[model samples]
Target: MSNQDSEPEIDNSDLEGNSRSQSSFGDAIEDQEDELGSSESGEQKSVTSDSSEDEEQNEIIRTGAMIQQSKGRKINKNERITPPFITKYELARVIGTRALQISKNSPIYVDPKDSIDPITIAEQEFNENKIPFIIRRYLPNGNFEDWELQELERLD
Candidate 1:
């Protein structure tokens, strides 16, 4: 009764998770010259739980920088066999809006033909538009025909 009552009633699960998440690779860290428990003189500290945020804030990936890729996964039917590949910087530059701001109805409109593919329209939009904007295809992951970067193909 004495030891149990005296013990702190803190749950450390969340604290442990927070500590473990920060140890993720490729995170941004700004160092300070102040003593322990001291705040920076004129800098606002930024903090968050998302691991990917670290790469965006600090320096961008230069040439020959290491990038994380899924290594041991076997080729599965669910996975996209031929997904579009663009440079990271090029993708960022082309997509004026982030994934959040892109709307499903924004691109890939109905075609004049009886049956048309969405990917063709998407490809069309991406190729024709002078000002780069986010072009998201609504088609499921594997079948790119439903969602494409080109405007019109044989089906279109």
Candidate 2:
């Protein structure tokens, strides 16, 4: 086939349709305003009380007053939130007190040179960059900061 036969045919109606509405922008705008005014002036009937009352009664009570908060990343049971690596300051605190304690009421026996405390090792690893570990403690002490050399908190 020749190039002329290959070319797509344009619809003649589209060209005529566009030409029909080819009025000037100002004329088109003025025509729209005139149509609006004619519709408004055509009817002077006042709104009936019954129609207005029904509209007010039929008002939809939408339960959409709640603030739409942006969604965050979802957490699944298969997923876990890893805590930020402990810093040097945090490590020292855990090793010297929390990890060292054998009993809450009893005094702690801690020897940094030969200590097998998981918390101490974890803390040291976190702060000093020793090695990654999976630590497990049956009883976790929650009183390291309570009685430390730092004396950070004042208990009255």
| Leading candidate by lDDT | 2
Output the worst ten-in-a-row residue range by lDDT, candidate 2: 137-146
10-101 in candidate 1: lDDT tens per residue? 89886765553343442322222233226555666888532234334221211222233222222333554434544454344344332222
User: Over all chains combined, what TM-score does candidate 1 have?
Assistant: 0.19
**Global local distance difference test of model 2:** 0.37
lDDT scores for all predictions?
0.35, 0.37
> Cα RMSD to native, each candidate?
16.0, 25.9
Per-candidate TM vs. native?
0.19, 0.18
- Lowest summed lDDT across 10 adjacent residues in model 1 is found at 143-152
